[model samples]
Target: MYFVYDIGGTFIKFALMENNGNIKMKDKFPTTAKSAEELVAQMVEKFLPYKKAVKGIAVSCPGVVDSEKGVIYQGGSLLFMHEKNLAEMLARECHVPVVLQNDAKSAALAELWLGVAKDVHSATILTLGSGVGGGIIMDGKLQSGYHLMAGEVSYMESDFDTEKLRGEFFGRTGSAVELIKRIATKKNLTDKKDGEQVFALIAHGDEEANAIFNDYIYGLAVQILNIQYLIDPEIIAIGGGISAQPIVVERLNEAVAQIKAANPFHAAKPNIVTCRFQNDANLYGALYNFFIQFADEVI
Candidate 1:
């Protein structure tokens, strides 16, 4: 079995799985460490529990990852990971072959290899969580772009002026956090609540909640429409924590219908679906990376 890790800003999700995408064990822990040393130590401890059975380590990291060099140029949320040779460092400590992949690209790889996009020629995944993350596949290949920033949809700017503020990119405008914040503010909730709580209010058909929810879904629809115009993929998959909610897919489709009806020039109706892997996409994708890297070897 190979160990795979999906390294995020606030948590590290790890799993042990075979090359066939069958997971044997999986768990996650908070990413409290801020520095490289602490981060390495944390990973080392996690690996210690499954050391003997693990043959290699594959990481799905959030950054401008140079998979060829096993280095991260710019860590998205973990600034300390910048300029770090993560695969090498972790390999030295864990004593295993290591490979690294950008988180978004990994998700796309997962879909192409064994998930929803497996039978499709080209597909894209737009992850709506704290921000808008994405992965694109074209002609059965992942498009990393010239700067290895092909799928960084979080940086995409909306047509509206709200995204002009510093750090207020499309991610801030079209994301679950934004939706929850809108609902919380509208409902005058004192304590901060998560997307689930806010969604519950929307389910109850609260007037203010419905308004906020509709606006949020509309914002996401705009982004999806923009994606269709640009990439024109065969299908687009919506992934992230919120996508697990059945209402999210229903609402997004409704918004898409509205947008399409409003525009006569837009003839393309890109097929959109919810991601199948959900939270475990990165993990399965990371294992796929490991599999491809060692294709000559039998596991």
Candidate 2:
């Protein structure tokens, strides 16, 4: 058996799974640590009970990760993790070998291993949640650029004229969560009436909802087009809570079409599709990473 962890901004999701990626058990807890040392300690405390039962641990975390070195160059939300060798830290405490990969890259790995991008020569996996994050697979292998930050589409600047939004990261503007919050605030709603209510308004042709949603879609379309010009991947997979909605693909494609209309530079179009995995992708991906790294010992 193997233990896999998907470390997110808000929670750390851990799982026990077989070598074949079948999860036997899973759970999550708030990620409240303020520093890397504390974060490592927190995770260690959680897995201690199962430490003896598993052969190895695989972690999917945010930031620019050097998988080969087991080091995090920069942390996205877990800012304290920058420069931390989490794998070494975990191994030292539990004395079990650990492998670490960037969270977005792990999701993409899951898709490439057994999901949508399977057997594809090239593809991009975009995880759109609170903020945008994703990974790229080129030549049938994941590409972690020199800085280990390839496919970080979220970091790109969004061209917006509004003073508040001007120069904002596309990751923030292209977020479904943000769109929901924007609509909820405008519609005077509570948490319970957030995502569904927002989508419902758009579905009912509420002009304000449609305008806000269109802005979000426009940002996405520009980036998707940029990606097409850059790598021309066969498929761009979008994974997140919002991707579950069929309208997201449909609306995004419509936005892409609007942008491509009579635009000479827009020669090749993007082939966008929803990812096979969603919220649980990182868990499966971490398991797959473990399977590949600790094959001899794990299997």
Task: Quantify all predictions' global Cα lDDT against the true fold.
Answer: 0.85, 0.86
Candidate 1 per-residue C-alpha lDDT over 154-249 given as tens digits, one digit per residue, 9 for 90 to 100:
898766465555444787887777778878887888745567778788898888899878877888888888898889999999888888888988
**TM-scores across all candidates?**
0.92, 0.93
Model 1's lDDT to the true fold? 0.85
14-121, model 2: which lDDT tens digit per residue?
998887788889999999999888888888987898887988889999988888778997788888899999999998998888999988889998998889998888
Once superposed on the true structure, which residue ranges of model 2 sit more than 4 Å away at CA?
160-166, 295-299
lDDT at residue 268 of model 2 (Cα atoms): 71
RMSD of each: 2.3, 2.5
